[model samples]
Target: MKTDTVITKPLLEIDKSIDALVKQIELLSFVNPTNIEEEKARFFSSKYLTQPVFKYPDINFDRFKLHRKLFKQQIELIEDERIKNLYEDIIYTYSGLIKCIETIGSGKKFYYNSLHCFGTPTEIDVENAKYILHFEDEDLDSQAFAPKYNAKEAESFFRAYSEQYDFTYHIKHSDKISAIAMVSNNAKTLVLNTNHVYSDNEIAVLTNHEIGVHMVTTMNGLLHPLKIFSHGFPNNEETQEGLAVFAEYMSNNLTVTRLKELAYRVIAVNSLSKGYSFSKTFRLLHNQYDLEKEAAYYITVRAHRGGGFTKDYLYLTGLKKVYDYYHANKNLSLLLTGKVSLEYADDIESLIEKGLAVPAKHITDAYAENSNTNKTVDFILKNLK
Candidate 1:
């Protein structure tokens, strides 16, 4: 360890305890209730083929409840009032994540709990997706980026992207998830779906959004004196994902097709609260919305995967909120301090003043002034109602 580490008194002690507490709060690795691809493949190969009914991975509910109680107890033991409030928010967020995990395998109740956690898409949100549905972009309609690259080739691209920032991480191939980037136990892993072929937009978006923001913040969190910085703040998903999507926009790779995909996700999530079935949601996107059948299948699976995960709707919601924040001339650097939320900008500032946090070691590349390439996408983002 470096000698320059500013080991403040009780704050450092609090940080150590919070860091240890977060070990049991692993969300990204086990967020999905089931391995969706296997279910789909099994359904396709059956003699009597049928719609896939997903079975979630078994989580230790009893063990998690114990962890929850411990986290609550930890929050109560903190001495400083401001520090205590910060931890109170952190513990609250982690507790919500725990509830999401516990409720995953359950059906409509899961949807109800999810809505309680990540709010349901509003009437305007549904209309925004509908408006995006009718948008006809001849350029995006062409499907210019062919799916030709294999897993090894894609891995090379990801490695090259990481190399640009002196980032050290591992790349793994699996058919389990489309593509997910995670930071766990001081190790970083990026998993790719080897079964699906890649396109330029798909590759570029992941490069900027996942690597540029998510990984950047992950590394920055390690630099903090507080462990809560690493675990994330309450409602961090909306801002974190918003920042990731904003990175896509800043890098000049965000497309109408991609934005429409996010819109479709909001629509799919909206269908869940309305009690739409798997086939019903798929038909709503394919027949009614006129999405490609292949695209429709994935969207339905994502929204319906854990019986009713409403989290997908937040991608669009986050994008809008982040966009508005940026346009308002708010400080994006505060968000980059760690896996943080816009709601706690003041808390972060306070930490910096008291030597509990430091400036971001690796500044987000997307935050640099942009070239402003796509006007239409910019216009829509600007006018998102």
Candidate 2:
């Protein structure tokens, strides 16, 4: 006697499967810091395990093909043009995610990952880029005061931050490198690989950049309603890194030297893509660019670490792009959430405005801010737009 609903059972099944797949993959973390040789060995040596493959409709290389696809699938589902447009604008971001994976697999190279982004178009640019690092004697002197990557410092920072935020976090340390931070739902962790090697200036920048900005955004995204918050949009690092550096600027910690350091990173990374060896790249930075040995070594190692790869250039390059975007009066809030880029900001904001940008179901602790967030936001708004 009752009329049937417009939605049928088959449609319901697809939704259920999507939900299940999302659940299965949501919390998985893949952390591979191995060099290119190791990654190559692992990739080829792995036995061909049975895997399900689905051929989505082939995406054309036409301009905005990704935008069209998102409109048909991801964007249309949202039911709000404002939010839909935001998603549409950022469809190309996935290219960065893909590029990151590709660069890791192939050698150093850059390319136009999206309509708004450009970099090395061939494999050779990785080795042709240049790099230089500059620091004063006082900066070197301050290096002795920097925190060591031992359990003591790790436990201290983790405990202090945990107490402030009321959530548990972990730490990872490596003697050979500086530091890296990894964030996921309900947890934050720092990897102090080169804690022994970084100067005080670098340490301050790293701590605030990684813990304050990266970790804070991860926890914030976790508080959103969608799981996508934690996964981050494509090419999210550009905005995130820029915001981190911006945060440094906001905190009165930004320096021209830091900016130059990132520029050098891009140059060094560009060189690695061209197959430059560590020593050769070192000379380029030292002799050609007139950088100190220590500085050149840092740049060289970044390129050499992943089998003569230069993906690290994106950090600096991404920061500059994001900064420019901010000044151009673009949406900058989404970046406050996670490793997303400025390119996706308008899209995310549109979604938020339309109520589609709901909070995630779970979140870690929020860091205690000694100052008002509005002050920083206002400062950024004035400088940016």
Candidate 3:
């Protein structure tokens, strides 16, 4: 006997309501604290001699609490166990996000959410950064370090790639971000840092990382029956970033400098867990390790922002997991099913089988071609512990 499961009308209404509420909670838009520009100026004005003092943006905890109440109420009303678990996962992710917003500027409180949201760097993570630190690259040689394009040039190059996919998005300049793809329910915008110098090849790498995966996933998620796919699953950061970096590799643009940047992020993030202050982390990278003052400052600001951010360490970790999984011949389609988690690939399969989700509308063109021909890069990415 075949029993057909019916989705009730009330469930439909609840899904729509939850989607609207989640859209209202713009995590990234709110997470970049307003004081970054001020602090960056302060740090530079002191000629890298003084610690940065950051001012956090105000978050309305009262509104967030009320929304959480409504989220809990909605979750309680869900009849399907699998769907209920998904909703619960979203609520937990939201709670962590709220904690991150509330704890900004406070060292202890922000570290709590940083642990919950991104996790502390493990001993393995610490060792990986140390190992990568000693790497000598010819690419770092001055004769090979010509950055021909600035942000405007980089943005123009990105536009060509974006046009190929018929992706309509906006480019915005920011003093804070070092080129980020911002995807929300209603907008797709890439924020480029005017302070960072970009090369032609760097834009290609960013094209693959930001637009190829992030923006493609954004458009794909919009075609889904549920909105959670668009917003990202719990801990979607790891897999999404891994996939993006993989795209960079597939397109033959992943460089040793990029890998070193990821390594530096791990070291800086670990410094936070070890109770290092902003100046302490900066000195460790700049004075002790001899990283360029500009690059060192960029790395320090990321980990020390909001007192103790640990999110940057996940890039290397994510690269390892996604590459290992791909090397095993698992279907990439499962990963491209919108902003998803590798942990929940099975759940995504179940959702597709149940007709709750569809196959990706726009697969990344970068991944469609096998162009990563660098063996040394492959060896390092594959062998990372």
List the candidates' TM-scores in order.
0.89, 0.60, 0.91
Q: Which pairs, if any, clash in model 1?
A: none
**Measured by C-alpha RMSD in angstroms, how accurate is candidate 2?**
10.3
Query: What is the Cα-based lDDT of residue 362 in candidate 1?
Result: 77
Candidate 2 stretches with Cα past 4 Å from truth are 1-118, 121-151, 161-168, 175-187, 194-200, 273-275, 304-310, 321-332, 358-385
Write the residue-wise lDDT of candidate 2 on 84-193 in tens digits: 45444444444333333333323333222221233432332223222213333124344444645544454455445445453345776644232243434334566654
Q: For model 3, how does the per-residue alpha-carbon lDDT over 255-320 read when each residue is reduced to its tens digit? A: 777788899899999888788878889889998888887788878877877768788898889888
**Which TM-score value belongs to model 2?**
0.60
Q: What's model 3's overall lDDT?
A: 0.76
Lowest summed lDDT across 10 adjacent residues in model 1 is found at: 1-10
Model 1 lDDT per residue over 239-350, tens place:
8889989989888887777889999999999998788887788788888888886788788887877668788888888888888999899888888878888888888887
lDDT of 1: 0.74
